[model samples]
Target: MKIAVPVVDDSLRMAGNAGHTPYFAIFNLNGGMFKTFALEGLRANPKVVVGEDHHDHDEHHTCDHDEGDVEHIKAHDTMAGTIEDCDYLVVKMACKNTAKSMSNVGVKLQKYNGIETSASKVLSELASQFK
Candidate 1:
């Protein structure tokens, strides 16, 4: 089994929110032994932003979606694709859209409710559960 957790920096701290985190620490489990698999960067899926007058914007921005935004859907689709090989995603917090997108791709979302924890620690706890 593979578990993906959004991370903040090289220290491998668990990111508070998955939507904006740029890195993911992947853990691989085999026979109840878990090991670090990889540290992956987020794959970019750029959106062409056109202004009201039909001019493209130079800066990047996350579009505010109201349940049916195509751009929003595409963004989450890309996010989900980043960890598509993983069986589960462990996050401290994730927005509704992110959770929905992950679920759509068959990735289970696991929430950690305690204080800030490192990705390694989170994987340690998860390994205990599978034992």
Candidate 2:
């Protein structure tokens, strides 16, 4: 499983969407252990490749179509694809459209109320749900 946590420039979870979502802290989890080694603070790279193959296989999938209709097509596609691959998300707030789009891709949205949540606090809060 994987988790996608957005953050501000400060590395805290991101709060909202804007003209663009600049970056994401993607956690690559194996067995839900939440290992420190799995946390990756990914910066928004415009040309990032995100296809089913990029997530696993090595082939670069192709879309046989034009990209001009979508203004920020690359960025939007990457972000949405990344979110889709994630099983969990730590988000502050987002437009309903973004939320719905994410849901369409099976991303589980975990809305955080504030921006200053500590790592330990996050663990504690999540643990409570299981208890």
> 1-131 in candidate 2: lDDT tens per residue?
56665544435444254213455666665433443326655655243442323221112222333446364454445566756777766655554445545667777777555435543345335532221
- Among these predicted structures, which one has the highest TM-score? 1
What's the lDDT for candidate 1?
0.66
What is the TM-score of candidate 1?
0.72
Give TM-scores for every candidate, taking all chains together and pairing residue i with residue i. 0.72, 0.54
Local distance difference test, each candidate: 0.66, 0.49
Question: What's the lDDT for residue 25 in model 2?
Answer: 64
| Ten residues in sequence with the least summed lDDT for candidate 2 | 52-61
lDDT of 1 at 79: 82
